[model samples]
Target: MSRRLVPLALTLALGLAPVVAVTTGATAGQAERRAAPSRTVDLPDGWQPEGVTTGRRGKVYSGSLADGSILRLNPRTNRTVVLPDSAVGKPSVGLDYDKRRRILWVAGGPEGEIRAVRLGTGEVLRTYTLPAAANDRFVNDLVVTSGAVYATDSANQELGVVELPAGLTLPPSGAATLLPLTGELVYQDGFNANGIVESNRGNWLVLVQSNTGRLFRVNAATGRTLQIDLDGRRVRNGDGLEAKGDLLYVVRNANNRIDVYDLKRNVRSGDRVKVIRTPDFDTPTTATVVRRSLWVANARFGVDDPETASYWLTRVDR
Candidate 1:
């Protein structure tokens, strides 16, 4: 079996603070202020939370490594319950829910399997094995829309879109092959696009290079791509990305921080720049903005110790 090799393609940015002030539309001004930071809830013993998503009812579903389980964190009751245990048999990297079907989809992890589990009865309704020429390929992070699920392939250096049909099987066709990242433009060691999120503008997909910290915008209709960051330099080890309205939140892995960029604030060459930096994080790997608050998954594994990995979930006020 093939395994991924590590390379020093990351940089650390430290001692920075939020510097940009955002002015929004008149209607947005009337909206309430973003929520304040909340107390971090440590997971139960052996429950290593990796990814988080909010359910239709505002409940938080945290993906855990302990038993490959999803846990519903009920803050009001101060209780956690293992949910959608069908995920227990699979290695789940990222978790997101489809409100229309009430199905929870988890990106493939070590096993390269994407699963759709019914939240109502905790049954795995379907599974899709990633098709790859490389044996070590796996799905990293994913974003689900009304029609399809777009997942990033770290090992194979590709992007895959899995369509959701009734009964949910891997589509017989319609998988997309993204434009290859090569030459001096490619970030990381051969296009390791680890994190993926939809553009705040709601039309494009933002793919982050884990090793190089470069961001690329992928066209939804055509697989054609453009580098969002023109410099081809590291912004921090870009791990996971989350877009809440016009703001894009990115997890800076090497720096152990979360950085926010305003999509509307373009400074040079029509590219958005990082404006806020929140440090004091431990290998912060992925972020999700829910309930007007930002949640981070601290993987706790960095350049210092890439072999051993552990994680916890934390929240920050916007």
Candidate 2:
């Protein structure tokens, strides 16, 4: 073992898998914390890309709100590849991928629809519709757990919990059952629950309300929730949430920034750690963590010409 401390230059190449430029004898997860330079990729416009997710080997996926198409993008190559027969359910706002089972879960907007699509063949494995009030639903973000997936319903203030059988794959017969939210997480007039994620151990689920920018900790089983106090401050316009262990990233759309926090004591109260921002942010709707970097999808909802070929995804170094 060497006892000398030397500055190490790590490079995580963009592509299906990261090709390191320097050797530091660090695991991929550890290298992610220190490696990986940030860059932004231009997305073909008019797709209205919103949902962003990462599969193994740093393969990124985004859904089109305008055409219901799912695009697989290689960040390392800056190319978009189409998945065969994969387009289904327009406005796929939020997405999650199950690497073990090769499943991609999609959440639809307004209609409150959910779809389980097989990754390789682009087959629709199952479809579940979440119950919500008429004309007032935004089936928002979702988090995949070891045994289940918890999704947030913005309009109705509920969570649709879909339990995965032992294989981490859902049968066509499986459905999304409602976990009615109560207590402090009552119905706020608009966009109540937007982004969602589970704790590192998959023990509890974290939810963010878009309108109030409030955070809630929920028991994964019983639907019990409590407000997470944040030092007497509010995260207004909070959209998407990503949690890794005790660390959390809150995406504030239109604010063009993501706030990082330390979630201590089961995320009861979070201490703000850092603020990530970029001039490339154009109403970033959601973000996904790949290794130690954050890939943000620009929704461009504020732009008058969302159809213009000017949308893009920005990479942020963490």
Measured against the true structure, the TM-scores of the candidates, in listed sequence, are 0.74, 0.84
Task: Give the alpha-carbon lDDT of every model.
Answer: 0.60, 0.74
Listed per candidate, the RMSD to the true structure in angstroms reads 8.5, 11.4
Top candidate when judged by lDDT against the true structure: 2
Model 1, 100-160: lDDT tens digits are 7777877767666666776755566667666654547667778877667878777765556
Candidate 1: what lDDT? 0.60
Q: Where does candidate 1 clash, by residue pair?
A: none
Best by TM-score: 2
| lDDT (tens digit, per residue) of candidate 2 on 1-318 | 111111122111100111113335978666446433557786666778888888767888888887667788787787977677776646778989887777888887776778887766556788788764655667888888888877888777678877788865465644578887876887666567888888764467888887777898888888888889899867766888877678889988756578888988666888999877655676677888877789998776634455664677889887
